[model samples]
Target: MKIPQKPNDLNEIFKNNIIKLMKLFEEKEVKEFIGEANNKYIHWDKLRRLKMPGNEKPDMIWALIKLSRMVTYRNIKFNKYVFNYSSLSEFQKRLHLLDKGMGGKILSNNGSVIISSQERERYILSSLMEEAIASSQLEGAVTTRKLAKEILRSNKKPKTYSEQMIMNGYITMQEIIKIKEKKLTKGLILKLHKSITKDTLKDKKYEDTFRDNNEVVVGDSIELDKIYHQPPNYKEIPKLIDELCEFVNNDEKEFIHPIIKGIILHFLIGYIHPFEDGNGRTARTLFYWYALTRGYWLFEFMAISRIILRSKVKYGMAYLYTETDDNDITYFIDYNLKCIEKAMRDMNSYIDRKQKEQTELLNIVKKIKNINLRQAELLKEAVKESEKPITISEVINTFGVAYDTARNDLLQLSKSGYLEKTKIQKKYLFRINKDKIITELK
Candidate 1:
């Protein structure tokens, strides 16, 4: 994409009469400059489309953006990167609601306000799997969700580059969960990169190593020279990374909201591009790491990647908006907040649908005296349209039960004629018998 044109110099516009800027700002049109969703935090690229001139031109919009910024870190002044809006607008407040919704109100297995430990574990596994699949897809890994999930659930070895990428994502996310309480360090960051890109990068030597050469550039394959971003120089990477860690570890300083700080960390990794490969994956993973570390526990189960994948062009544009417009970063923050909002909405909807399915299953299985909730849950999944044939390994992974327990659960269902069991290649697979299940319900 062509680089966005920079806004005209605001200094030149206000050089003669500084009060002219104030008078112009006081005008009714200026006061009423509320843009639509498309115009929210109007970047110069979009603002230039407006029919205004001189001081009232799109440069005025840039001026407004600058005016809106509230610097979070006073120490980083020259390239004042960390910032947010001076005041939260209604739009931002609504998005904050979504961020807060991570603390979901759903009842746990124990009928408590807090999630039961068992249910929380299940949500974490589901989240890890989702993030793995979606993060890999974002980085151009091609594989079906069904197959990727099966590979993870069965603990089968990954056979292809795409599958490896998915597995790497799963492993990296799990590692992040374990280390969430630890402070960020260069070593930990490198370890994460290694875990995410192992067996996937073309140059095996560069798996965990920060790029030591200036050859990295972000842009389209067709036009390599038309660089979208040239990250900080390789020579400066070590110091930059150290500074990033310090910033992330600073909790006692003038407080930056944890959610916003997490978004900033996500943007910084992309801006720095410390790795030769897996930068996007690492950046996204680090976003999760920061949120979880900062006590945004429910963020573990929200798949931001799925929301971002739906509008990748906008995702890229959010970065461009920040880079082109004085490194305000509010643009990127706004975009991420929107993604989190949508993700939380999606999570809530998923819970509602799953609860409905479970309720229906309970209603049907109430007549059967001996079955457990786990059995009923599996049966509910079996009746879904185009459901895949089940396996004991899948049951083990799904319910986090032991191998013996999962095997017995399926065996009991099969014996009751709710499932048809068959063996292929020494592995037992169970297919749902829809007619038998319906008859049992009747």
Candidate 2:
């Protein structure tokens, strides 16, 4: 309960532009701005949420990551890039420069490439990501263990949070369908408990936050950087947890756009900061879980964490921005809206790429002179899997084949041009041309 009272203080965040934008955003027209910023003389070029489902909708993470792309696209549309770069990387670099020069980074309080420990800020980002994804795609959840798996998947060996390694991108997410059928026990919980830091349980930092201890305060006497630096007041923690659990579990707003509801839950739970450690990660994962509960994307991919990793500065700025203005949530809303807008555009682009890739694979399949029933079955399975590129080992197991025999079939098909090899790590990945196979079947 010890909140910072000044800008210079670590707990205190003051950002005037955010306040100014909130005032401007109060106008009702701002909420309707899908394409209006280009012609207006507004202080901030606010892009409104389209409230439309993407052509090929993504899950929670997909939605967050896509927002980055959407925001980038909108910036180029409304603001000049001053270059005709042929690739997205080149384009992004130019835009990043322009954004920095125009005070985007400053306005966002993100001069540093990596954003550090500000549990409150992470809470806000989690809420924003949930809202953004719900608005464009279906609902879903990101489990803590799932996230730990992600961190593990990245092939890093920090053994602890450090630098950019603190990113939530590494959280492993499995489909809700995959989790609901299971039961949680002491063993399961403890096994998964290893995913986060153990000191978090008793570390005053985690304790203050999880318990919601009100004794902590950011008065003039306390050092500035240490304000958001304390723990949560745990005395009344159960009350807030019950309140959010009730709302999330049985609220009448079930019919409301799951995205909006997800955002609301994110704020409440995060505001509660229920865990000793990994509260931020927990809030975000909860948001993901809430989205998934309402029926969302499968977890073969993750995008929201990626979005957090990407616009971390803006993510932090939103938190600090609100602090300077008597805790007015309007700036917070605007910041999230922008994030949502960006997610939509990113999803659009992803859908476009996925469709394009599938199209090319289909063409490759059709040109094949001969494909028997067996290859046709494998092709069907690949399409049905519909996740990241499937590996050669998967093929061998799919039919319970001998290693060399499976290898021969894959090599022959790859050589004959029926399948494409996307990458070669421990094993190769084979992508079949489903579209071509369908055409041949027709």
Candidate 3:
């Protein structure tokens, strides 16, 4: 990504045309100027094209853009990096409203059914698989989603480097869930990095350690010379981290919205590039950590990285837009909020499809046999996909039934030819008996 051109100084631009600027302001062009800035809180380069016919001077446009920014602070101990953003605009207000509405839906009774309350473990596992795979893919890990899911589900050790990265991410996500309530600390951050980069980093020593000697750069992959960002010197890292933890711990002066605070935590880590490797993965993991900790239960089911991976270039541009234009974080915040909204939409679509299939399966099973509701639901899941294999423990977990009750449910299905049973080690695994199922259901 090429660096955004720095806007010309506002004072220098107006010095030669003070009278003309005054005239424009007095003529009620002040409203127009503010309106232009309000359109999208866009940077000067992008905002310049929207300039009115008579308002084409680059410097004047630049000055007006500068005047629009509202400074916000993210306190780091020794060297704080203050950011600025335009006050929330109409677009943001609508997005937040939509976001809040969606969040509410996911926490309601209907939401529980949509999420398969009886099979929450499965839903959570599926979400973890999707997030882990997509997050690794964002860092250039190469593996098909099908193959990755297979590897994770089968409990097989990862073979290739890419697969390992995906597995490491999966493990890290589970760990994040476990530790979400714990305070964010330097030690915890190190633990996350080590978990994610274990056996994956080329330089093993870099694991679990901040980059003290190595130089890190964010730039175009194809054109490495086009540097987009350079993080603070390593000497600043310890104090920076202290400040970061302070913010995370809520030992700060102001109250930032939980979602915004999480976004900033994500962006600041990437900007700092404190670690030599796994910075991206670590940054993303922190996002999940902070969000889940703040009681956004619906986030557990969101595959945000999948949405982000689809538009990785825009993801980079969001960061660059903030850094290059000024410390304005609105660009990055807006992008992430959109990503969350997209993820919610996808999640709803997934639930709708599953619900439809569940109904279809239940209807078919009811016609086939005098089965209980649990058995009917289980059959729907079994026949829906070859990937969904049932174990006694899962049935017990999903339906909150006793072990024997869950076992008998599957056992009865097996005896009735609705499912095939296989003994793997000591436990039984049941899957749809394809031949019997298709013939009977038809």
Best by lDDT: 3
Runs of candidate 3 with Cα error greater than 4 angstroms are: 14-16, 27-30, 71-80, 91-113, 368-413, 421-432
Q: Write the per-residue lDDT of candidate 3 for residues 372-404, one digit (tens) a residue.
A: 767887877676686677888767545556789
Displacement of residue 430 (Cα, Å) in model 3 is 6.1
Best-fitting candidate, scored by TM-score: 1
Q: lDDT for model 2, on a 0 to 1 scale?
A: 0.41
| Model 1 residue 125 distance off true place after TM-score fit, in angstroms | 2.2
- Name the candidate, 1 or 3, with the larger TM-score value: 1
Clash number for model 2?
A: 40
How does candidate 1 score on lDDT? Answer: 0.77
lDDT of 1 at 357: 65
Model 1 misplaced regions, further than 4 Å: 16-19, 34-39, 53-56, 60-87, 90-116, 385-388
State TM-scores per candidate: 0.89, 0.44, 0.85
Where model 2 places Cα greater than 4 Å from the true spot, the runs are: 1-172, 175-224, 229-231, 253-257, 296-302, 323-326, 369-442
Model 1 lDDT per residue over 1-442, tens place = 5677767775675575467667665666665563332246667677678765344656654565444343331223213344333324744585477555656566434444433566566667787888899989988989888888889887778999999999999889988988998999999899999999999998999997899898998887678668888887888888888888998998886677788778888988999899899999999999999998977877877889988988887888788877776676777887888888888778777776666666676787697657887788788778884267888888777767788999999999999888889999999988888887777777
lDDT of 2 by residue, 171-258 (tens): 2233222454333222222222233333324463552334345654322234655454333366656554554555556546434344
